[model samples]
Target: MNATTQDIEQLGINTVRVLSADAVQKANSGHPGTPMGIAPIGHVLWAHTMNYNPKNPEWPNRDRFILSAGHACMLQYSYLYLTGYDISLDDIKNFRQLHSKAAGHPEYGLVDGVDVTTGPLGQGFANGVGFAIAQKHLAARYNKAGFNLFDYKIYAICSDGDIMEGVTAEAASLAGHLRLGNMIYFYDDNHISIEGDTSLAFDEDVAKRFEAYGWHVQTVADGNDLKALTEAVKNAKEETERPSLIKVRTHIGFGSPNKVDKASAHGSPLGADEVKLVKKNFGFDPEQSFVVPDEVLNYYRGKGDEGVRLEQKWNELYQSYKEKYPELWTEYDLERTGKLPDGWKDKLPVFDPAEGKVATRKASGKVLNAIADSLPGLIGGSADLAPSTDTNLDKYTSFTKDDRSGRNFHFGIREHAMGAALNGIALTKGLIPYGATFLIFSEYMRPPIRLAAIMKVRPIFIYTHDSIGLGEDGTTHQPVEQLISLRSIPNLMVIRPADANETAQAWRVAIEHKDGPVAIVLTRQSIPVIDQSKFAKAIELEKGAYILSDSEKEPDIILIGTGSEVALLIDAQARLKEESIAARVISMPSWELFEKQDAAYKEKVFPKAMKKRLAVEAGSVLGWHKYVTDEGDTIGMTTFGESAPAEDLYKEFGFTTDNVVSRAKALINR
Candidate 1:
């Protein structure tokens, strides 16, 4: 590089540093240290290394960048502004303000060029792994020998907190095992954490740990050495069999006078005096904030133009490939646009009530295999519980290191990593991903599930073993409160289906609902299918709650239930009619979906005249009170389940026709 070019690059890097500090200082609450220290890293990746078009941020083959340490979002915002993305200088000035694009942490849809939300530490790292997986799968499936249609790299800047997180460890292990060569991560090894130096708790050699995980690891002694960082990245790209990690040692507060290498700099801003001193140290105007020299702006915009040209070249190559392989190109286009093939729903199986009883989990497996041939974008796996959760697509081979074209995945006992990886795949545009585990273990993956809800992405979650019905596993495996907990999260639709038909409808809801995440809760034990001929159609499951059977006139009591308990409610209703009493049976499958219905529709399902109501379920009854009135009663488990046969457990827990009839009769008398 020439002397003038080198001077301009340095000026641009310093501009990012000062602008980040100014934003945090003005906000009065933000993390500014890592951004100040890692500005050169961003400058190298965005301006010199990565191929990304700011003019079209959604370019399919462009390299993806994620800031796993999202507290330093000012660094990303400043780079996006400088590189001519949609972010403006005014947006930078409004950091952390209400309704501003510049949130305290990087949010995916709120800001341009941010690949995923990354506030809770290690989720971004796992998300990058998911991105690499999608890239490899697409490349293997679509890229012919002459047509390299999908060859994109995934890059992320992680920190000490990110590395310390166990979720990153799990995701790193999986990435190394899969031999994802397209992933490159930089560890900002600044040694200082919020508490103090990392020695207080974290002292392990992370590079060695990654080396044990089958990754190519390199270390740069100084973070500011741009030449070394660039060379390391090049070497990583050359190693086409393993994921790479470049550990760059850096100072926490690089140019700040008083707060350098101190814990105070990790989150809190360097005060006004120190900010001015830092600018003076960098030879910038001490009085100026958010200043961008004309030369630096022009230099970065030139790099942006280069990105546009690169994308245009790819587009030209794609056009040629389209001509050579017309049908394949059309399929690829559909995948990218998220448009399901016509008649895809025709493949979904509907169960008949006359057929023998079937577990909801087993019914789910049938639905998955039935639709797998039609929906090419559907891909996922269980956390080493495919057989138990009944989530495997038997028609496809398992996704392994040697074969990336398979539709099935073996996430291998990593629930947290699997959740975050699903988020990554959902963000990758072309694919719809799902992950499965026991409903009780959802607690382990709640962070990513909540993130998916917050980002409004569509990642289906198959959580089988819905309640205390999983026999012999006892209290530890039985989920008493999982349903209520999952239902409590806003924008997350939790559907506990009644039988085989409702299970099929639940899968339909999961696939068709694109607004946010959906959790289909299923049962391990067999439950009889409701006869659609005698009752309402199973398609009514979309309305969330519906009256299955009612008396000729206004019912004396209402018996509401979900999942397996609905079968018991049906039996109880029949018995009440034999005794000259009238009762109504309501199938309340999903509270979130039902709440979305209009007030008149809700009133139609639960009439105001029927004040006497009874709710029956094998789980906690925390939220059932909303449907059941003050005079109503709930027959739910008040204690943990015991290790016994499923039938005995149901009887012991009062999940039976007798219990439902008694509860309904008592409510009617009251």
Candidate 2:
């Protein structure tokens, strides 16, 4: 790079720093240090290192970048604005405002170039690992000797907090084990957090830890040395056998005079006067905020033209590739659009409902095998629970760093790693990835699940042992609050299907959903299939909640349940009818879906005018407050359950027909 080029690059990086500080200062409430410290690193990575098309942010082969330390969202927003993405300077001015593209944190679909949504610490780190793995798999499946179909890298900028988080350790360990050489990360060693120096809580040698995990580690002493930063990145790219971590030692708020390295500079913007002083110190107009020199604007805007040319070059190569390998080109085109083969779903085995009762988990395996036959892009495995969760497809091979065409992944027992890796697979376009484990273990996978929600990636979570009915394994194995906790996450669809048909429907919905993640909560115990011929159509589950069985007329009472408990409500309805009581049984598979139903439809199912209702579920009653009205009761556990046989445990825990009948009767009397 020439002297002028370096100046131009500095202008771009400085513009980001000033714009971020200005935006945060104007908002009067935001983090500033991270943006300032990470500006140079972000600049070098986006402008020189990463391969992305600003015009086509969704380019399937583009390199993925994640700001794992998302509190420094200004770093990303600034880069988005300058790099000719769709974001405007005015949008940056409106940072943190409602509906602004620049939200408090980087959200996936909300921003054009952001690869993943990140706010929770360490999530982005793991997501970066996921993106790297996806590239490896895609390359192995498509690239021939002359056809480098997929060759993109995953770059992430993390902070001390991100490295300190347990989830980060979990993700890094897996990334190392997978030998993903395409993954590169920069640690912003600012040594500061909300509580002053991170040394107070984190003094461990991160490089040593990563090295122990089998990663290539490099350290740059100064953050401002572009030459060193570039060299380090080059070295990282050269290492093709292991992932690389470049620890960049940076001064927090490097150019700010009064706040550099201070805890106050980390979260709060420097006051207006102090900002002016800092601008003057940096040889800029003291009074001006967010001022971009014309030369700087011209230099950065020119990147858009360069990007178009780069894309054209790639297109020319792609054309040649198509001519040389038509079959591979066709396969690539199908994968890019995320389309399943015409006969993919044909093999989805449908077990006879009359066939002896089977655990939903076992049924899930049959469904997966059928889907796998038709959908070559469908790939995933469990967190060392595939055999138990019944998630592995028979005859499918395992996916290794060397073998990416396999349909199954051995995620060991690392739930957190499995979740992050699934996100990576989903982020890699043309793949439909899933992760599985017992529902109770969702807590371990929650961070990645939240990232999936934030990124709006369609990562299917197959969670069996969904309730207290899991039994014998004890309360520790039960998921009392998982449903509500999962439902609380935005963009995550929590589907607890009642039977075989509903399970099929759940899979269909998950498969068809292009945005957001979906969890299919299943049961360890067999749930009787609701006879669609006698009851309401199973298709009604699409509405989220529907009257599975209705009385001859408008019912005097309603029994609402989900998953396995729907059978209990059906049995309770029979006993109520014998006593001349009119009761309707509703199977509520997904509260999020039910809420999507029109008010009229919702009222028709759980009439606003009716007060007699009973909510029966073998989980926490936290989220039932809205459906149950005056005198309505919820029969669910409030505490952990005991270890015992599932049937006896259900009876002992008041998840019995008698309990349901009594609860309904009490509601009617009220």
Candidate 3:
């Protein structure tokens, strides 16, 4: 017996809904309404619009899909299962259970088809835009005559809450500006939210608003009409100058007799009676729970076969391209594997201590340019402060979706999207992404940074203008608490280099430490490079901290500082020596790295015998407690910054060498 296309689609859609509802009901928890309401959309996209092989979810050219409204994870899980991925029915049954592959939300490495871990409302929406941006860039960079190697779409399903987020608006605006035609979004206009109809708070014309953002907007009056969804997506694919948003009107709980179209259906599980009634409405046995018809299972199982064939075809095509263009194939393969080309680090500049004072920010640019030569996969841009941040790689062209040959990106003022996009590129496997902005504005990039850390993706963040030394830009631009705040976040390595040489080492750590996210916090003002010949090599930065100055006997006082303030501490140590005060200076670039050091190394750096410890930083003293005991004094800011030159600001804020010396003497006497 043969089945018509309509029969196949209906069976697939109902299967997804039943599986999702059953999974939620079995767990006695979860948002089933969204999966049920959006099953047809998922069905049309996964089975029809998307070019993917569940057997090879990591196919570089496979279209990407993000369930932006990730609270309804059952939708993605059902698709992963039916499409012949590694996910099994038992995985669905164990939804939200500890250690289950089917987590409450989609996590990248945990689930087979999950592109990114996205449960934080609007993050998925923004991350989807980033994925689309990566696709656009890759396509432009590698595609050639008869070698459209990177033509793939990025699709996302967003709910009312996802659209209501501020990041969504920002990301959507950027998507439009970049004209990511391959990016498509389906908005589930189901009316009911967790608090009843979105009418209670959100009633704006979403399609009209998207139009204002330069997106090609469309509306399908009936979301269940798979034909209409297919047509709308077809039109969206043909649009080359804009991203597309399709407002899909859907029922909250389609076919559920008691729960359909109600707010109660949005979050909670329907009762047994309602579940039975819903099954009856779908022409199923009322008493049977989690019952998937043989025909439905057989139909979904066939997807595995279809996916294998698709990947086989792609492999053949890749083989043909390889034979015709061996060099391009080699480059593409190397990039796809995410391995840096040889000698990338050799290009990193080594600063000479003989060259007076140099700001770490300037050194950062030099380091980036050096690494950029070796790391072809490295792509980045700054948030309108590239000149000040010194993050631009010299002579490298800027990457526009229109022209993909450029390695650098220009993110304008969208630090939030820049961070999210960097994650997207990093998720692409073969790309190393970094972004830049002032240290103070890291707050804007914090969410994606946290996600990057959680996902364990190495996306470097070059944050300059680190602390009160930012000077005349004043308190608003100065990052007083930002250092400690970044330090507080788990899995995030915050590195504040003391000088130009340490800046190079910090870059090394950021690139080499692939387990998690790393932020290279640099300074706006110049700092004296410690003479490695006089003391230990800058390579000691890997230990997190090393003594730059020491005495024959146990020091009377110890001075600890990071970034630019380390220079001030060195000067203070000289003054103390003049006064016959024995003081040691320690340059601690990263507290997180230091804490990871062996106990013996830590003790050696800051000896337990030296009870008189003092930390002199130009910012808030929150992070100094561990280094400086409660009995010791911390000479640092307790408040916001003022408008003044960096030198005067240091003097006025009592961060000068004289103040450090005075504080150290006072702490020693106490």
Candidate 4:
């Protein structure tokens, strides 16, 4: 008797479920229940619903799949192996092990098919929104009369934990408002959390909530119902106006008779006996593990073959498009490879000291618009703080439902979602996405920033009101700890430019930085542009820390500062000259970039002989010890600031030339 297609399909799905359970049981860790429950969803997506080429995971037009519930990464790993991605079965067996491709969660660069690094629940959900926005923008910009080059959709499997995360709520609201028709999500409505049934805490009309969010909603009664899952995906694909969410009710630990629908199987491995029972129940040999029947392999590989054919057809269309629209083709190619056009950097604005005082944020606005046309993929917006953040692109129209080709974005007041969405947009090849808000509100964006660092993706974060400078808003609005807090995050480049020229150079560094994320902290108050002819050129800002004004002889003391404080130090250097004191002022914009320099270069900048040093910054003085040394002292905020003007706040907080010179004298005397 011959086995039918349905029989092979069910076998393929159960094989993943059994393999997943076995890996967890062997590792003695990981969530066994979600994987066992969502095997059908995984199977339906990889084998039936999505368009992806296993042979080339980086194919730009492929449909993206994000596992929002990253604890259930085994489900993704199993399917990735079965579908012939670069991940092997051995890699799957070594789940959660150090240096293994199968990390505890799906990390973007580690695994071949993992699109974004996701573990903190709703971040991946928000990333899907970014991916959707990228698809729309690219489709509108690149797709021609006969070519649909960017029509691929973004998909994600979100769990109840994801739904409960605040970031997801923010992302969902924005996705609905934008009518991201290219986005579809699978909400895994497994009623079990680590505690117990969701009834222990959550019991709300989720479908109605999504409906209210302007999303097209659907429900599949059973997780095991492959036809229903496929049909739901079909319906979601048909809704081309609003983003779609299909809520599927699943039984956690579906095959473990005792742990089924129980929280016991949520984060731990099923016992050995229960694993045997699961294998036996699934009609597989209980003794044998990680068993993938030859027929099931053929079935999934056959599905992968479909992607090859589809991509071939697309390649043909792209060839014709390249010929028909040569100029557009060049721009598209540049975006795809993330290469800037020839002489694009020549467009960067150079500020003159004679121009008077200019806020770094204002200079940043000029820099953004200066090169906006040169860098087609340079697109971003502020989180409803464009006027204050100075993040708007002047020449372009706004990117809205009506116009997707616009470079400017209005992320509204959703910083959490904006950050998460920027991560998604960064993952999309050919786009450099940035988002902005006040420095104090960076607390809302820390998670996404950390994840972006983990993924080593490029997403420029423009943080203005960088100190107690935006004074009238008071202590609550001022950021005394944000600079040091952001600096603490590994792989994140935190730069606080001193003047307009340095701010312009910071933008150049941000555009050229290929590694992790960059945070450009700007000032709300005006700062005098340093005279380039009298001191070093502003291009020296790329070195992270540079000597702005050096003493004719070996300096008696070193004065260090970042952002606005650099101006104070420069003035202190001048005042110290009158007192017959030789003082050198150093502008240290980025510690991460400075650390990357060689030891010899570092020693040259901060010689061990120079024990008399003083550093000034408006933010926390905590991390300054590394630069100032034990013998040196720093003039910075030791406590929260008050609601006074910037000048008074600076005076009250001791960020002044007199205080700096006094601190320098004290340091030298010590």
Instruction: For each candidate in the order shown, give its overall lDDT on alpha carbons.
Output: 0.91, 0.85, 0.84, 0.92
State the lDDT at 7 in candidate 1. 95
Error of 4 at 239 (Å): 0.5
Better of 1 and 4 by lDDT: 4
Model 2: per-residue Cα lDDT over 1-670, one tens digit each: 7899888888778777788788999888788888988888988887788888889988776778889999999999887777789898898889899888989999888889988888889888988877887788778777889768688888999999899888788888888888989989999999999999988898989899999988999999999999899999999999988999999999888789889999998888788987787778667898777787877777766775577677777788888989988977887788778775676555656657677677778778878887876677788899888888898878888888767777788887888878987887788778899999999999999888987887788899999998878888887788888888999999899998888778887887788877799999999988776677777455576789988899997788888998889889999999999999999988899998888889899888988877788898888898898898765889998888889888988988899999898878877876
**Poorest stretch of ten by lDDT in candidate 1:** 531-540
True-vs-predicted CA distance for residue 33, candidate 2, Å = 2.1
List residue ranges in candidate 2 displaced over 4 A. 323-328, 338-345, 534-538, 608-610
Return the TM-score for each candidate structure: 0.99, 0.94, 0.95, 0.99
What is the per-residue lDDT of model 3 for residues 63-148, given as tens digits with 9 covering 90 to 100? 89888899889999988888778988888889888899988889988978888988887888889876877777777766778878
lDDT of 4 by residue, 286-372 (tens): 998878899998888888888988899989988899899989998988878878889988998988889799999999999999999
Better of 1 and 2 by TM-score: 1
Candidate 2, residue 567: CA error in Å?
1.9
Model 4 weakest 10-residue run by lDDT: 532-541
Candidate 4: residue 438 Cα off by (Å): 0.1
Model 4: CA > 4 A from native: 1-3, 536-538
Higher-scoring candidate on lDDT, 1 or 2: 1
> What TM-score does candidate 1 get on C-alpha atoms?
0.99
Best by lDDT: 4
lDDT of 4 at 290: 79
